[model samples]
Target: MMKTKKLIIVGASGFAEIAHEYFDADTEYEVVAYAVEEEFLKTDTLNGLPVVAFETMHQRFAPQEHSVFVAATYTQLNRLRARLAAASKEKGYALASYISPRAFIWRNVELGEHCFIFEDNTVQPFVKVGNNVVMWSGNHIGHHSKIKDNCFISSHVVISGFCDIGENSFLGVNCTIINNIEIAKDNWIGPAVTITHNTDVAAFFKPAKHEPASVNTYRFLRIKEE
Candidate 1:
């Protein structure tokens, strides 16, 4: 909150483009450039910002002067973001967090470094968040929700009150978590999963069904381990 901050978006993606709107609308940070990996550097301008080589963008604007944020959306994309953060640090540039102005976050809602929160996210009171949490648009994080570190929550997720989301968990689009639920670490909650209770640690819940006569692998796969 000292000088006006400048940002370099790390991906030339639709998600990145959408994030630009939130950044522009909410924060005082000005996105002066867009950055991509050497291979994905297509056009020069994204959202009217110059496209710079992510590999060396920090040379022009030192991390002390400017900050960077990742904008990828894939489940595995967070690893790459972590790498980018390391790379940026090597260049002496710090990673940044973008919290939307339109989002309703109550006081004492803890946020860690490098968290990206988009518009329309209603984060209630007593919510605890850890580092590297990417919460996309339109999420309702109910009160007393505890989100562990390195969680990726896609758009429109409804996490009810007292939900405990574990570390490295990936909650896909439109996922719903009922109250008092404790999702264990490393669980992949596939899109539209309405979780009502505690899930086993390291579980993968994908909505699967049978085409008639074919074994319902989803149902069959639910049997307890021998």
Candidate 2:
């Protein structure tokens, strides 16, 4: 039988716990430890494993024997995740990728290292997902779409065919990128918004504010009195 590769997750927060669960359950990676910055190190243990300072984690867990996954969210515009991913590579640790079994990824699709593709994601043919990209559950990535590195796609998003999402972009939940659209780098697309064409670099797009309905649900139902 093939032995599973030991891994150290680069975080200790809730997202790191989720990454640990996914990598443990679906992949061949055995999470051995958690690593965070010295200043952020509050606890000594997480998920029953020793939490070490990232500065000296390499000394404890040799990179030649262990792999790493930066289990960080899209905070700081994904710049922090990108920086950590690069640092892990520099430390001679091979980055890991996790694709959920419930996700439908085509055979021809290309996924880069350190990617996290969650359940119910329908990644069609000819799709290329770059490194450090996070696709939350239930996103539809149409054919010929290319998601660049450090991009975070939220749940229920629809990226139609021939779309190109640039690096460090964040697409919020329920957003739709129409066919032939190219979202530029560092763009932040808010929830429920639709992009029909190309977007400028570092642009922030959000849906219009929604007002409360004048009639409540109880009033609209009009119940008959006895």
Candidate 3:
């Protein structure tokens, strides 16, 4: 397929590379270049594409012709991505969203710009996904659930119906949010956590650290410790 719409990804990190791969393979947007802040600009090319300075990228790829996608992770509680996205828009670049063809999105689901929904994600009816939201693969966003702006939802999360995930929150991999739960803004729910009740603003929920057995595994299994 001929990809007519040009796209510039903001960032040169691993996540940015992944975003390039996804957009190139699945979407109509042809990722032409990668952009980063001048202070952090290192390589001239990433994934065979030119790595340009974000400050002056618009000069080469005019915002009127090219769109941008900020491929930042949950750094600084998603503030970095949000800031870059806002800056890109201020530069007159239209924010591009990528919804995987493999993902199942109900007709009533409302997805905002700059959002990235990966494969195997099931966004049911009445789900409202806000801008700059990143939903990794294999998540189930139930009916009437609202994932606010700038949130990063890791893989295999199960958000039940009527849940309200607040803005700038990071839902870790394998986390489960029960029905009717409201996760407050800036909350960090760590891996394997199960949230059953409403969370306060800026709440941090992490799974208990694993305690290894006192006996060595080699000794227990009667094997040599190499």
Candidate 4:
């Protein structure tokens, strides 16, 4: 049996905690510690492991012996995760990727490092997912699709075949992108929005909020008020 590799997660947020659970239970990586910026290092322990300061983490866990995964969300349009992953690489730590065992990834899919693919994600054939990308649960990445680096795809997103999602883009929950569409870099597509054509760089698309009806629930249902 292959020995499980020791890993250090870079972040102290909820995402880091989730990454710990997934890495510990599903992947071959054994999460040994959590690292955060010194200012945010409030507690010394998280999930029964040492929470070290990111600035001096190398002193404790040598980069040659441990790998790192930046467990950050789509903060600053994924710039934070990208920066931390780059920093971890600069510190001589190999970036770790986590593809859930429950995800259905095709044999020809080309996935890059530092990517976190959650459960129920279906990555079709010939898909190329770049580094520092995060795909949340239940996302469908169609055949021949290319997700560029630093992209964040939220839950239940659908990207049809031959789509090219550019770098640093964030696809919100339940958003749909049609086939052959090219989503430009740094785009922010809001939840439930459907894109039929290519997007410009840094484009922001949001669905209109549903307005509440003037009639109360009791009146709309013809029921007596409590």
lDDT of 4 by residue, 92-187 (tens): 999999999899999999999899999999999999999999999999999999999999999999999999999999999999999999999999
Error of 1 at 191 (Å): 2.2
* lDDT scores in order: 0.83, 0.93, 0.96, 0.95
The sequence of per-residue lDDT tens digits that candidate 2 reaches over residues 1-226 is 1337998999998889999999988888999999998999999998789999998999999999999999998999898888988998899999988899999999999999899999999999999999899999999999999999999999999999999999999999999999999999999999999999899999999777999799866677886544
**In model 2, where do residues sit more than 4 Å from their true spots?**
1-3, 223-226
Worst 10 residues of 1 by lDDT: 73-82
lDDT of 4 at 26: 78
Arranged by lDDT with the best first, the candidates are: 3, 4, 2, 1
In terms of TM-score, which candidate is strongest? 4
lDDT of 3 by residue, 7-98 (tens): 99999888998999999898789999999999999899988899999999999999999999999999999999999999999999999999
Q: Report the Cα lDDT for residue 43, model 3.
A: 90
Q: Could you give me the TM-score of model 1 versus the true structure? A: 0.82
Error of 3 at 105 (Å): 0.8
Candidate 1, residue 39: lDDT: 79
The collision pairs in model 1 are: 63-93
Which ranges in model 4 have alpha carbons more than 4 Å from their true place?
A: 1-3
